[model samples]
Target chain A: MARFKNKNKKAPVRPVKNQPSVDHITGQKIPKSFVFSRGKLPGPLRDLELDLRKLMLPHTALKLKEKKRNKLKDFLNVAGPMGVTHFLMISNPKSIPHLRVARTPQGPTITFEIHEYALAADIARSQARPSCPKELFSNSPLIVLSGFGSGGQHLKLTTIMFQNIFPAIDINTVKLSSCRRIVLLNYNNETKLIDFRHYFIRLQPIGVSQRIRKFVQKHEVPDLRNLQDVSDFVTKVNRASTKSAVRLQEIGPRMTLRLVKIEEGLCSGAVIFSEFGKEADDAHEEEDHED
Target chain B: MAAELQTLEAAAAPASRKRKPKHKKSKNPSKRAKQKASPMAAAKPRQPSKKMKKLFRKRAREYHSDEEDDGDVEREEEPSSGDEEDFDVRDDGSGGSEGDDEEDGRGAQHGITRFVGGCRAFRVAFMKIMKKHLPDDPLGPILSAHKKLVAEKLAEDDAEHKKKGETKKEKQLAAENGHIKPANFLDAKEKFLIGVATKGVVKLFNAVSKAQNAQIGLNPSKSKDTKGVESKIVTCFFSFIHFVVLAKRRKQAFFSELQKKNTQVSNSRNDEKGNVTGWAPLCDSYMLTSSKLKDWDKMAEPAAVVGQEHESSESSDE
Candidate 1:
């Protein structure tokens, strides 16, 4: 019996801790809704951080994509009459896999570990955020590069972009009395639209206004006078806004961003994506929601 | 088609001149702030009748005369310079004299009577003044002709009003007021309609768009089958699909069906004697008809709803 007890003690003691468990891959809250969310390490990429490994999986990537789509649909669904605030979105461009670029009040910033993927982070830092769709934008951070470490930690970074420029858009809720656009969101949020470089390609204020008016007319609505009365309501953006537009400064452990605008009524935005540890606020949120 | 033609003719006539319903309100000589019960504050202080002015001044020499002493009755004074100023903002600017004289002439000749509903005593006072001011004689025949011309001109003015109304409709559709801007065929079908309220897609709610959008489900079952039948039955007033089928015989059948709907108008055939047209009652109804068959057709109900909207649009265009 003493020999058996000695054998039990002799076996290598596995490390144990009293801290709360976390989703190792996302560094996000894994709620009771999750059936099996624990991360699996890959043979070759295992040495990379767990967050880096998470990006490599087809399933997780798909899940993240679905997560965004559902959020978009949910937002469009709920944001109709009642209002929404702090609504978050994660957009995936066809070009990048690991990048979780988000449009926010701050300029566009990237999130990634510095040491683990030194070469990839360095290259990303060198590239400038593109600026054609926008006369100004933010990109390429060095701190995001600095944060990358080979240790198996899950890190997330959110980059904020898209400044709402509909002047006084937040001051009042608009009711489209004539048209049947059942999915109209608050004007402030509409300016938060994504990938709109395609929508304005052949756009004209008069023509677009006419088409929308024609829809009202077809509905047998008697008149569309108020909108017509203000012919100068020509642009979606308030080029005259006074607020600052966001610009990207640095990326690494955290993103440093600033906003500047040329006109008085508009705002520029920034986005920073940083990976938080699993036992952080998000986990607390998950716990709070669980009960 | 004939009913539509009459609406067109009515719309095409020049501005008609209707005798303006001269419900002329007499002026007030007293200049007082408007009280709800007030007519025009009494007019221009009455130039003070010679004897009244003498006594009023004599009373005032004691140093004060309350406004009540003006002896200004709340009478419906004849339309005067002051009354011109009181006319509504769409002022004809002819001043009170012209508007009143025209009113007096027309009212006296046509035996026009305007009934005032508010303030019984005030209205009674107004009638006394109306009878007193009524023109002593009708204006000469030339005046009558001129007045008739004006009334006809006013009626025709409706056509002009509608012409401006068409352009106004486009603006109004942009604006959203209540005048039923004339409609056209393109407006009969809208591109986007509310689909299922839960589904954000118009394809679910908008029958028209649903029928048109191909990437969605195959055309609704009924719409697919009915594509070959040639008629304008428009069966699916509430269906979630819209398909236009083109078969000619069906249109002829539809006309026959419509003919059956208006039996009296369709049945009447009057036989007129050589020169004297006798009042032979059609269908011998108590709502005796002396009007021609064409006029009876003009009053047809289906034609009124189905064609009036189109008639207004076509007439406005012409």
Candidate 2:
């Protein structure tokens, strides 16, 4: 009778517990992220958000539910308990896709205006054969930041923010097997644009004949119809290198981002830098006048 | 000094005619006496009066406003020359350059020198509103909590590593005794399943490519290869059907095996439930009561109709 009566009652709400996972070797708190869209996103932008979530794998909420009524404060409240270190929000307010990467709670948010983007599926369709294994997204991709070092103060901050968004790997203790993907951010000084590329890391052995390698890896029996002997397959002429090489094959949701604004707080606060704002130049002029 | 005074008098001559001659003559002696008392004021460059300073500031503000409107350059220059004539009438000496230097300094202080437009103006206004609402140091608590979490995690990791270090000596001793940890290997069933899945995928891909080639060969432009293409297509179609049937059979076999195992477990439960049959009687009684309730409405309607007919016959007899 009690069980039946209790069935109509609401379940008790559970309080969120703050328990951050730590790295075993480095003793650093593993950075986790939340990738969600704030406003209405186009279908392609939604897919881009999913790709970004996949890029921050193993520690991100890949299936986070967000409603129109939910505000940034709600995410911040939840982020505190979940130990979310960063938030990547995509919002397309007036047909312009803006991506905001902010450190959780109190932040130096970097907003990027996406000039162009290509989804992973589009990249795959253009390729002859796209290799995407199930384990490709099991670990977070390694971030390779380039051309950001020689820029201004805001660019330096952007470089640091991107570097810390993913988990930091101590080279001496890091395992090579865990690195299956790489996210490269290449900045072009001339155009003032950042080229974002996600690539799959492939390792191929050197000095291996193509026919024998295919047989070994794919278990495919090569045709020996024109060969004098089976030994001919093994002794096929191939370029031999002393060391095995690592190859990077782009498996991408590629993006070209122009840094539009940098705010002192999460999506708010004083504008530290802006590409389109006259205050940016005005501020520089003010500094010069002061000097 | 006498030559500079003559030049000053020449610049102020037009102003004396505009004003009364007697008033200009009365004020000139007092100005000369003040300049004579402070010879350094005369030696130094002439400074614009407060009125002239205000006019220069206004001209600068107008220039910025015109720039904001993207006004004509000639229009802006025309206003500047008229203001300079007003400056000549108001001061005894030419102070146009000094007024400009002072206005530049004041403009920088007031943030009015630069032409702020578009998003920069919005940003400035946004920061002002944000400052009004947000606390001066709102990040303190959030930052402290983050730091504390990192410190706690580091402490926990240190303890874990200490424990691991304690176990390392025993592991080394065991290794010395030739009882090292065994290498991890995949289970045979898992390995075989992986191999089977990979080979199956490769075969399907090859079959698909062969079909595509056959399709290309069957194009109307390649009429000479039609016969060979037809045969290849037929073989590929048959192989595809074969693979589908094999997959279907495998799925059926797996589900049937699961069903068999489930029924065996249920039958064992039935064999043990001979003494506990309370549920059967309870279910039978519940079904009987439900059926009786379902028939109650029909049974009551006939009774009410018979009563109504009797009542009608009684009234007719009366």
Chain A, model 1: TM: 0.16
Candidate 1: residue B128 Cα off by (Å): 23
Deviation (Å) of A275 in candidate 2: 1.3
TM-score of each: 0.16, 0.43
Off by over 4 Å in 1: A1-144, A147-291, B1-92, B95-97, B113-318
What residue runs in model 2 are displaced by over 4 Å at the alpha carbon? A1-20, A222-241, A278-291, B1-318
How well is each residue in B50-133 modelled by candidate 1, as lDDT tens digits?
664454345333322354432222222333323334333223332332344333223222222211111223324444554664
Cα lDDT, model 2, residue B236: 51
What would the per-residue lDDT of candidate 2 be over residues B1-318, giving only the tens digit for each residue?
334334444433323332343334435566544433443343233345566557545755665674654424433433233333333344434343223322322333332232222213333443455466544642332223266777677779999999999898665443233111211343463243333333433343334435544666655343322333334434554664586699999997797557547544233222223226632222446445542232433543444334345554665566
Against the true structure, candidate 1 reaches a TM-score of 0.16
Q: CA shift at B288, candidate 1, in angstroms?
A: 99
Model 2 C-alpha lDDT per residue in residues A61-92, reported as the tens digit of each score: 98899998888889999999788999999876
- The residue-by-residue lDDT of candidate 1 on A1-291, one tens digit each, is 454556546766669432222334434331111011112212222222232222212111212222312433343344332222222221111111122222222323232211112212332344364122221111110101111222222221221122211111110121111112121111112222111100001111122344332332243222334565322432322232211111222111111111111111111122122234435524423422221
Docking class of 2: incorrect
